[model samples]
Target: MSTATLPRTRSRSRVQAPKNPRDYVRIGLWIALAIVMVIWAMPMVFVFLTSIKSEADIFSTSSFAIPGAPEWQNYAEALATGNLMTAGGNSLLIALVKVPVGLFIAAAAAFALSRIRFKYDTLILGAFALGSMVPIQVALGPLFKTILDMGLLNNPLGVILPYIGFGLPMQVFILHGFFTQVPKEIDESVRVDGGGNLRLFLQFILPLSKPALAALFILDFVATWNEYAIALVILQNKASQTVPLAIQSFQSQFTSSYGPLNAFTIMSILPVLIIYLLFQRYFVQGMFTGAVKG
Candidate 1:
């Protein structure tokens, strides 16, 4: 009986705030980046999956399928059968010696080109630019002959010498761009302090150029480590073979053993990956800075 005069209540609806145009662009960029990352990572994921799978599992199941039981022995087999230890050691030594020596030579050349104005500087720089564009294949015959003549064939120096030669033009180009960005005042101040070119270069320029140097070091090291064509030509001796050559030999030797081959590949990639991860911060900065500054 008391329900005669009950009031009706209106329900309130929630209204959403309008999205900014920038929000959509940000979301689009993030989605694009995610897709790119997935695309890039797919091959690596498959390689890893294959590396741990049994030979039967690799062929029997889907490419992306997880293995029922991981064949951990694949790694051991790869290393032992490939003689990868000695190959890896040779690669490490080549990279260690080549990278620093190459960088120093490149830096010095860059310093000369960027600083001390001299006759034919532009012409010389043009020549280096020309040199960088020359394909390695074009020089292989002459390179091989020269190495043979020098008795450096089957020697690490054979590979090292060529690597340094090929690597220089690009390294010098990058370092020169970066070195030019250094203020003239710094060079003047160093000279005012009675510092010669060597002191200025060693004490000031090199320290200031660390980002560019680190970037070049990582790139040159990886390139040197993974180099195959030059290494194949120079390092004929099994004892002197680098990782890439050894991996090629391993593949040939173990044609049907996909598991161990994949494992060996993954192992070989680890050093370059580690080097990149260690110095990744400087890479982007150095590249963009060198590019944009000049």
Candidate 2:
């Protein structure tokens, strides 16, 4: 009776080991990536280590080693003596006003270029695309002089306007690509319901384009936050200086406030880091959204 029936059990698959030189490439790549990551992170590690140490320990101990005790006062000293507070406020004001305003304008322009067919759509979009290639330095003098003549120099408007203007080209370019990828059927459907271009943009395009907007917003915010050359040129009033300018002036004036400088640098970067973390989920998605049309 036992010989008449048989039960089958599944055989386990054997694990394969690397058998040739090329088979070891994956391991080599992982090692190389780890090494590169360590190298990339070393500077930040050094800065953080230096920021926590007293000036004495900063110089006495290994640059990457932990401090005997954290010199937390360095942050306070930096905040007190440095123009960081004013500069930070100015930076915040500029970014807050500039990012949303700039993104809206860019998104509108992109919508017009991508969704609304016009006689010169290609020409206009190409012009903006080309503008992104022009060096900011090329316009620096003209921008400064225009701001000076308009009595806006050393004012928040000067920074905000230029930021919006310069930020537009790239933002529009990005949004245009994303906008084109959006189904024309949506626009046609909206128009069939008696919607105009404005309604189409606000109600349909914007809601669907949040990731693209977030990605662009984060990038533009970082650029505006850390802008040095333009802010240095336009924002001459120490009271109106931005973080980059404040850090520059701080370094030049103090010369030896290494710990405070490091602390200030840390503090300055936190906002951008936080913003990145908040929007990071959309970052890769938005960046590649326009890459292919499927």
Candidate 3:
């Protein structure tokens, strides 16, 4: 056979290679994932398109239509009118303070639960697991009264304290699961080296659990930043409001101003997007590793 004919034959054989069921399954998953992503992104796309349009254009045109004249000033108007910067700062402060402190507390609790054998350890872990399932709404009434009695209403601490409490169960559960996967030999070695539990936890376990901690930090920060119900109850004043409460107030104030409303909505989520992007590399790995056991 001619060399050209041999090349053609080889190409044909490659093209005609048999497909595996697994290959088909993988392709199907990719297609499904793409569809799911598009479905999820549609609303954000609509919001973004609306954000850039003139007020008149928003009502006159289709939801997804590009603005004929992009209204860049909408962002400026939103920022000034909505007081979103102040609210965002409040949210950021709460997140930065709450996430680290909550994580530290959770890590300590998780270490005790996973590493130390004590009476009622199983019961305590079970309680935390059950606590994770309890709705925040269930405790809202009593929580409000407690905050009120303490004169913490409209204070950041009111929100921060509750956020920490609500966050602990899930954080402890995730960290405990991850900590259990750490080899017992390391714990034994640390003990043999005359290291106390605090030293082992602070130096060894924490260093080893960076991925899980990063994942929890991102998740917790986002939750705290976006939380509204508890914040609404605790932070009644405009100055103390977080992003979600501020957005609600902004929407109320700008009932007819669609452009500014959409602009504010987009801006409110930017911090969360930044945070997720920063830790996304660790998110899936941490979730899977921690979830594997619990």
Candidate 4:
């Protein structure tokens, strides 16, 4: 065979690695993102680690290191000692009752403000928005007195009623923005079909505003669940205390410990986290839609 015709094979294939400035920049960005993720995750990781550690280990060992044996009983002890089930039940009832009621009233008001075009519309909205700016602390004394006058102190209804009233401002504000973004043509079409405001709101408007409603409900649930000051003040009886108050009991004037408290905290956050995750897509969409449309 002729030398030129003979088959030639290379000993190795040359592979190129990233060498461009943009490629290096991409690599730098990935590294920075990873660092940020680690930083953000550390607190959550520490909480879980500390919750499963024995008190002795927690005090003797480094906060960053893992324990040899996880104290799963810490959760059980925390639950029993905190009376978490009762607190959790109270919180759940408040959320379930208040969320729907608040949403209905807010949605109706929002519909009137945005669609009906009644007199003093802007003035009404501004008044509600003003409530959002007023700190809860400012209202606590008056609210307490009102509850006392009404003979509702230490009652679940007291909390529920206040939650419904106080939660309305933000819910109305958000739903109004969402309701405004909805086309006017739809409302006119419904009216032309002989639909009244009630039918139109129930059949059309509420269905269209599910994302905003879910987002608002999730926010309300979390806020209501974690509320401490108002619950502490109003719920003088231990039986009516909510989860935040239960968590507070983990510390007393003479002694303070965080292991069992951390465990209860994790349990307390689970419901909120699960609900948020379930509705996360809608929540994100609702939030961004309100921002862009309004």
| CA lDDT scores, all candidates in order | 0.91, 0.90, 0.91, 0.85
Candidate 2 lDDT over residue span 26-94, tens digit each: 888999999999999999998888888897897788888888789999999989999988888999999
Model 3: residues with Cα > 4 Å off, grouped in runs: 1-22, 290-294
Tell me each candidate's TM-score: 0.90, 0.88, 0.90, 0.85
Question: How far off is residue 124 in model 2, in Å?
Answer: 1.2
lDDT of 1 at 71: 97
lDDT of 4 by residue, 1-294 (tens): 655666778689788876853778889999999999999999999999988998899999999789999998989878877768998899888888888888899999999998887789999999989887877888899899999999998888889898888888878987888898888888889889999889889999999998888889789888888888788879988798888887776555214557777788889889889889998998887777756534
Candidate 2 deviant stretches above 4 angstroms: 1-33, 290-294
Model 1 has an lDDT value of 0.91
Pairwise TM-score winner, candidates 2 and 4: 2
lDDT for residue 104 in candidate 1, whole number 0-100: 100
User: What TM-score quantifies how close candidate 4 is to the native fold?
Assistant: 0.85
**Range of the 10 consecutive residues with the lowest summed lDDT in candidate 3:** 5-14
- Per-residue lDDT tens digits for candidate 3, residues 1-294, read 655544444344446555643588889999999999999999999999999999789888899999778999999999888879899999999999999999999999999999999999999999999999999998999999999999999888999999999999999988998898899999899999999999999899999999999889988988898898899889988888899998899988889999899999999999999999989988877777745544
Write down the worst ten-residue block by lDDT for model 2.
17-26
